[model samples]
Target: MSPALRRHAPLVLVALLVLYPLLPFLDWAVTAIFGVRLQLDRQIINVMIFAILALALNLQVGYAGLLQLGIAAFFAIGAYTTGILTVDKYPFQLGFAGALLCAPVVAGLFGLLLGAPTIRLRGDYLAIVTLGFGEMTRVVILNLENITDGPRGLNPIPEPVLPDWLRDGLDRFLPADRIDLAAIHWIVLAALVGLLILMKNLERSRAGRALVALREDELVSGCMGIDPARTKLTAFAGGAAIAGLAGALYATNLRTTAEPNTYDFSYSIMVLCCLIIGGLGSLRGVVLGALVLLSFDNLVSPLLTRALQEQLGHDSTSVFANFANWRWLIFGGALILMMRFRPGGLWPARKREVDPATKADA
Candidate 1:
């Protein structure tokens, strides 16, 4: 392939992949070709949503070398922010767009506040602190009964206000069935594309270079005139903002209570795993990571459990029947295997390289 084709190939492939779900008879094709009812509609939407969270995480651990364990706190903050603003019991009733607009900003503000104090810490210290923040956020939400309805969480979060035409377009090919997420799915796909473009550009921007430099050596980066402190702060806040957006979307889609327990430390770790397994610092890696890991947990686990039960003699008390219950054990094993055999990831991000031709042009 030409250099240009090599460069653009990933983008082209992603575009096609994103569009495949919308095609007529795509579901039929999957069932016919693989004899597997691959219900991709919701699954693809889920992956795209989590992909945003994974991409957010890439900014910290992947690019800036910061160990963050509080990503879910920001996610919770975003979800709760929407809940407080949009739920009918609340006075604001900001609606979906308002919540969407404010979710990331609120999360970013929290990130800013979080980083201002802890940005100086590194490695495990930082991780512990962020982990504490995550737990604390959940605990606080659990206790805030008046504001958040405590453990029950806020409910009835509004959906996005899409145009009738867009909804109509989404229904053109599919049966007028369930929630009809076609429009929402398309919007989220657009957001993912926009985020990917933004992140790729950021990877090549001056700020991105400074972040990479800091990752390599904070002292050296500071000596070279890059403000390490500010860069770290930016990384934290920016990453949190992206995660918050994902959370807001999640809450809106569920249209149910945003339970405090749901945004616990485990959720943060799962998202972290998604980024790591996909290969840190790689946007495409995040997409793959979210799809692979989440699909395993959401889609494949059930099938595997049922198959095992049928083969091993169906018994709810039998270990085979509890296969789906081994979610974390499976994830933990996957993490270990990935770390051992493919530490860089299944689709690891390429190491940065300077092209003499491009440098000379610049």
Candidate 2:
């Protein structure tokens, strides 16, 4: 292939891969042969959402070297912000657009609050504080009965309102069980693509360099004129904002309750595991991480359950049917293996040379 073709091949492949599940033919073929139906539409939606969280997480964990074990705190903040705004639990209803606008801001503010005092600490200390923040956020949500309904959580969180014609075109015309409001998924995928571009740019920008410097050696970077605390805090806020945006989208897409249980410590650990298994400092790795975990959780595991049922008939236990429940155990093993064998991750980040032209411009 020509150099230009080589350059575009990955893009072409990714485009096909993203669109494949949306097409029915592949699903039909797989079901016909494997006797397991794949919920590709829901899987794709989830992959895109978690991919955003994983990417956001990379900012703090990979680039900034902050051990944030409480990312779900910000995620909860974002989700609850959207939930309270749009639901009837509050006197005011902000709707989907408002949720999108407000969720990230609230999450980022919380991030700022959490970072202001905690960024100075490092290693296990920082991790512990962040973990506390995560649990604390959940507790606060559980206690705030007036606005959040406490343990009941917020239900029927509204989805994005799109053009009526578009909705008709998708739901009315597409094959049954294909996907409703598929335009929503397309919009989200577009947003993810845009965010991915911005993140890639950020990785190449001066702020990215400052973050990397701090990650490498805080004391050395501080002596050379970098403000360690400020840089770390900035990264924390940015990551939180991204998580908040994702949280808003998540609540919207779920169209269900954004309960406190949903944003627990395990969720934070899961995203962290995704980042680690995918490869630190590798953008592609974040995508890979989401794909691996979500695909197993949503796609393969369910298929395994169906296959088990067919093999053993109705008497088969729910345990075999819901192997996805064991995802944490699977994730734990994957983390241990990754750390021991491929510490960099399944798709390790490659070091890029500094562009002199960009450096001089800086």
Candidate 3:
């Protein structure tokens, strides 16, 4: 690398690390330039949660080449686990920290339970089985009104409590209104950074290679003595654990948990879209995909809604102003165009080659 490139590499990485959480600060410039008031902080936090979810999905679809279509099930599992554990409800009152520790474990156990039976299946069958598992989970949550509160879900879940030292310092720096939001943002951002580092390390490990091999050719991998069943089950369980962690964070941040309806197929599809658009088997690609899709879903669509109302010269409630529903149509079309033009994704992973000299002569 050139001297300039080398010097700037660390800075670039640092900027990217900060970009997701700091996106809301950009609204200041937008407000100054375009006279638009935007809630960048809330949107960015939401995106961070989605980004973590995408990372988990990437582990399944990207690394293992598993077409898991029911990730939202794991997400819901985590959310409800956190809610039930942390909320001071009729029968439980575990702390947020305890919920954080236990939720992923429960979720991973569920993943193992689900994967054990289905990992032997391949392709579409595996996908269908997993999807059915996810839907079945939702139905159970929906019907368990006595415990889960059913469609009403759980409420008054406690906000994640911060250490006194940190809380005191934050209170000194920020006004009351900004303190809670800023704390949550920083905490979530920290969790995301931690997950990124962990996943990146996993991608470089021997186990990761086994996953890649399984993705490339399960039969050949099995012939080489790798247990495809064990590897796939591990990936499924690990990915589900990550999803569960994300769900816990989300519930604690929102201080509430919705019914199964809130975590339906649409959310699962969105997470899958993030992995597909980002690039299979690449962490950087997954993050990029999440940001792009989330930016469209949360930021661009809202702006377009306002723009359409202005162009129609009518109130937003008018039939001509029904631009919100069109957002998904446009998004779906864009996905098709992206797949058609760049099937490998915008930032596809570069294939690494094994040195010929290192290979045994056949």
Candidate 4:
């Protein structure tokens, strides 16, 4: 790459992401080349949502070195908060904007509630606690039929309202049938971009440094006057809030809260896998990992499986026709290979540089 191109690679990537939904012609091009229609808007939106989740998980697992196994609980909290506030069944009827504003706060509070007592736990014990918490949250939600509508989930959630000028501009590029989807795509994309900026800033903040110090050596961090409990709690709550935001976006996009079962251990593991595959402790790795993993799961697998099924005369019994079913096996092998070979990750975190003046003084 040219020097300028390399320097501005992030900006270029952002521009490409922003322009992706607007380029309807890519759908035609992809169809012509691949013989399968791509739901670019929906696919990208889903990827962005999971990307947000992975970023949130990265804040805990990657940044603070916390083993969080219950991120999905916070996710469920955010989605349900949005659903309860916006759904007509409840009187709040805060609409889409209200849900967006409130979901994170509610989720963050829950994060604090969970973290306050358990922040002292470490390693496998902490992971086990979080695992139990995740399962407990789902079970509680499942039993709350009166409040949550149980397995049926909440529905008819409010759709987002876009301003006329913005809508008009988008209408020019997107088909009328896809206007709403395009709007959602932009919303999720904006969230992803905003979160990335926030995370980048957080990494440079004093608190971020404290988290790193704590992650590296809790005893040393304590000797250096950093409160380990406070730092860990900050990471825990912040991660939960972000996950909540992701869940809200997911619910809005799907027009339902879905079921409590949706927020299970597997979801948390998937986000963790994204972080592991991408390179923990690196923001770029989080985004790249999310893109690679989510795109494969949402787009490539389904499309490839469908194509194979078609070729096999839609034979339900043929294993070749069910390529999508092998996702876990493929991911498992990928993880084993990654750990065996490139354990640092696809874009491993760079070591911090000591200041030249500090080094010289030392």
* Per-candidate total of colliding backbone pairs: 0, 0, 0, 0
| Candidate 4 CA-lDDT value | 0.88
Give the runs in model 1 whose Cα sits over 4 Å from its true position. 1-24, 28-39, 165-180, 354-362
Candidate that scores best on TM-score: 4
- Model 1 alpha-carbon miss at residue 111, Å: 0.8
Model 4 poorest 10 in a row by lDDT = 312-321
After superposition, candidate 2 runs with Cα above 4 Å error: 1-6, 17-30, 164-180, 305-322, 353-362
Give the poorly placed runs of model 4, Cα more than 4 Å off: 169-174, 307-321, 355-362
lDDT of 2: 0.83
TM-score of each: 0.89, 0.87, 0.90, 0.93
Q: lDDT by residue for model 2 over 135-232, one digit each (tens)? A: 98889888888778888778768777657876566676575345544555766687688788898898889999899988888889989999989989
Candidate No. with top lDDT? 4
Residue 320, candidate 3: alpha-carbon lDDT: 48
lDDT of 2 at 6: 88
lDDT by residue (1-362, candidate 4, tens digit) is 99998989989877987777677778788778877677666777888899899999999989898999999999999999999999999999999988999999999999999999998997678888888999999999889999999998888787786789988987776787567776787889899999999988988999888998899899999999999998899899999999999989999999999989999998888888888899988888988898899888867898788778778874867765687788888888877888899876899988889999999999
Ranking by TM-score: 4, 3, 1, 2
Kindly state the number of residue pairs that clash in model 2: 0
- Pairs of colliding residues, candidate 4: none
